[model samples]
Target: MLDYSVRTATTHTPEFLGLPQGAWVQEGGPQFAGQGVVVGLIDTGIDPTHPSFADDLSTDSYPVPAHYSGICEVTNDFPSGSCNRKLVGARHFAASAITRGVFNASQDLASPSDSDGHGTHTASIAAGNHGIPVVVAGHQFGNASGMAPRAHIAVYKALYKSFGGFAADVVAAIDQAAEDNVDIISLSITPNRRPPGLATFFNPIDMALLSAVKAGIFVVQAAGNTGPSPKSMSSYSPWIFTVGASAHDRVYNNYVVLGNNLTIQGVGLAPGTDGDSMYSLIAAPHALKNNTVSPTEMSLGECQDSSRLDADLIKGKILVCSYSIRFVLGLSSVKQALDTANNVSAAGVIFYLDPFVLGFQLNPTPMRMPGLIIPSSDDSKVFLTYYNDSLVRDETSGRIVRFDAVAKILGGLNPNYGNSAPKVMFYSARGPDPEDNSLSNADILKPNLIAPGSSIWGAWSSLGLDSAEFAGESFAMLSGTSMAAPHVAGLAALIKQKFPSFSPAAIASALSTTTTLSDRQGKPIMAQRTYSNPDSTQSPATAFDMGNGFVNATAALDPGIIFDCAQ
Candidate 1:
């Protein structure tokens, strides 16, 4: 649910963690901004024509590496002109999606041009044209730059619009990336599940990535978003740079001020205060199911099933949806909720995070009425308090007290509610390596480390933006480990530039060994989705919270030296 609004431009990257300005760059150490390295993006394809991929500033250090065997696969939908110097290669894999009857050729683009903005945004994050102009809804956002502005980008279209493509498709994509002989692969693809009782190698994608790593390409994958929960990680391959997420000092906060004046702060790609709105709020106390389904199951008002709701009570009211237990009954996506709302003719819906599951997941579905996901921290307290207050209410009185909420999107032009950066994002999937490596005999700690992923601003495709909500801009902001992986991907490209002979293992070692443990507060770093004692608001993070810690590109640049294992 990559529900992010376009953000005013913000400059971040290896420099955000101290690249050229840091001591490493000061020492005249090689500050390689990925000069000759090529990054293979195996996600949805890329939009070559976006300002981010312009060849105006691309360096002519290498004319497509000698090992690159990949061709610019051309079709009617994707012409040969699409591949420029910046986007060195482009290809797509629809085998699995085609076989599954999920690939709707009519609706989804057949070429490498990303109809889904994710690929373009990610590609830009890795190696987009530096200093592209940005404007969102006519608002002037300053120029933006990629982490590795001078690096080359080759794209493999494995993931597709609406998340089409199966594991087999992903495997094929990896195989193609490997064949292309890319220097580094930044795979933002996340798996739906960890194969039960199977070694990581048993999974086709893992095997494929391992092969890519063996070929000397540094592989960076998104640590799953199911975070703070120890062992809920999915990208568990030991050989890959499984990257997790951390918040940058610049936070994208959405503030929801309830009718009771209880203002709660959550996260998303904020649209600034100008986008704020006020709405009537309604909440369902119990999520218990009726005779048809299990008990204690319900949605506050997420429109999971309009039938499950008291249509009379919910109509004309802002529905408050809560996740009790994945306690879903028929409602699958936010679209379904929109349909239900249209059916009921409701004003809007406010999604409150259940303290238990409490993700405040960034991906979102557009609403017929206004929709905002209330953060778990504040909403949980509100829910508990509201439930208690409702106990004394007399339903027979035929009068119900309602709560109104003010939704304020804060960032860019708005008063900045900044964050203490390098903190483990509440949603970054934690790890202790959820898999049993006994079979593969390669037990390794996971998420490798964290990077600035929360509400990251990057280039987006106008073709893709039409289908999405919130942003009518050329650039969009996204969050999650998906955004984090490319930060490392860009860094890996820089590392490759500095040491072209180093193996993937050596690059991973340098990154892991040089991580920082303390955060902006000078306190021990903490990961998301964790709670301890005292106030229980936040608990001490463990190795699983942040495998190594926040990534430091400056330190990683000159790790002194790295030793690769070989007989």
Candidate 2:
């Protein structure tokens, strides 16, 4: 057994920004605990012992256990030569090694044990045992669990341990899942680049998705994390439920600072009093500290021992440091400062921004340290003016002030950045048209729905962040549409739990029609640009980017209009 710890159960419930929490609970909870549904998850396999789905397995074949009904469609070889790094242990490799009659071949195709933790994390979220004693990545495990704890799950090993797999294998897995009579199919994988002559191979996958849809099996796919762009993977497929990412909070505690040289007359400046404040002070130029090199031409060793950073150089004076400088040193510098706060105390660390990089701050782990980031353009002018004029005094203030960084539950729709406010993540792929190449004007007619993906906290492997190089881990925070698809799959289980009579198309319809158009900011969620043509008349509101806003489980369960596809 790999030494893995469980994540702490979050007190906050996941919510769709701009969507009502009450509606979610009322519609999804009461209607869909997915009583008799069996969902087939095709990707990396699941850890059968995970707590969330402890009760979901069954040894008997037909008339499966009430909670679940399926078997592991074990197809690939174990411990093949290619899988040396992914599948550890001689025991896991025994079967494959014996069958191949050679250790080298065994290493090439390792057994279905998850070398990359992605499959396990997705599985746990979709339908793991409800409770367990595992702690990982600061998360503890217990009953506060997946969307469909009672739903049964079937695992398929399609993607290889090397993170690549034959497309044919995937098509086979789909056929197997369908033959197994799975009520839903969840796929989080995508092609690296469209395979050469992709349409030929893709036609089958496309047909598989449509075939699943026709079989009354709801198919949920990740919208891919290739961001700032609208085109991402099979997300364009019309028959499949495509999901995008959104921030969990409506308001983020982000700050906009002005420097001493900038005009500060209108803004307040009483140290910490004004949310945004600027001051005029001469400080060290650029020097590295804590293994970090300055953005300008300077080495880490030279900067650490340089006299420019001494108290004499910065004492009682405001210092400006560029954010770009820290990357050279890594986040370890931040951690070190927090660890040694009492030993080597400083006034504060102010970050100067550079135009080349957009500043998107991650939630700091060591909660109690003060740091601030200023835009590069703003910081440059301040630096120049303060350097030239010794008597320059700058002031600044703003409504956007730093708030304690803590994850919180955000409900309903609002677009302002505030504490724990949800927004569409910077990396979530957008859509203007569905895969069918239809030109529907509204997102409600296209891209379709949203789900939980992007920086999602979940199960991790024991290897830790540094060791687990691939996308999934024994435990860690992962971002991408891959994370989101499972959430929808789990919800599909819930939908089946409530309306056993509903067809997959009806379920997809309920999910689509119930989606909200406004984002956390209350602005209409729209698709990003799909083509370079400047005259493109399509806006974000049309079927281009925001397919029907995001998925709303609550509304879907109680949808007023159910889609009735023509037979």
* TM-score of every prediction relative to native: 0.73, 0.61
Give the per-residue lDDT of model 2 (tens digit) for 221-267.
Answer: 77665554544434556677877655454221333233422332111
Please give, for residues 1-567, the per-residue lDDT of candidate 1 as tens digits.
Answer: 111111101355544677647633533432235767889998777777788877754445436566667788888767877776667899887776777676877656777777777888888888776667766544554667777777788998877765455777777778988888898998887767665556654677788888888877889999877776777677787788888888777543455555455666644332333334554444543222242222254543445666665566555555656644352222344455556655665565555565665433543222334445555645567754754464333368633434334333333233244445567777678776765533244367788888888767778776674234433457776777888898889887777777788889888878888888887778777554543221244555666777888898878878876757641
The regions of model 1 sitting more than 4 angstroms off are: 1-10, 13-15, 23-32, 57-62, 254-412, 415-419, 437-442, 465-467, 470-472, 530-536
Off by over 4 Å in 2: 1-13, 17-32, 45-69, 72-112, 124-144, 160-164, 198-202, 227-233, 250-426, 432-445, 452-455, 464-475, 519-523, 526-540
TM-score top scorer: 1
RMSD of each predicted structure? 7.9, 10.5
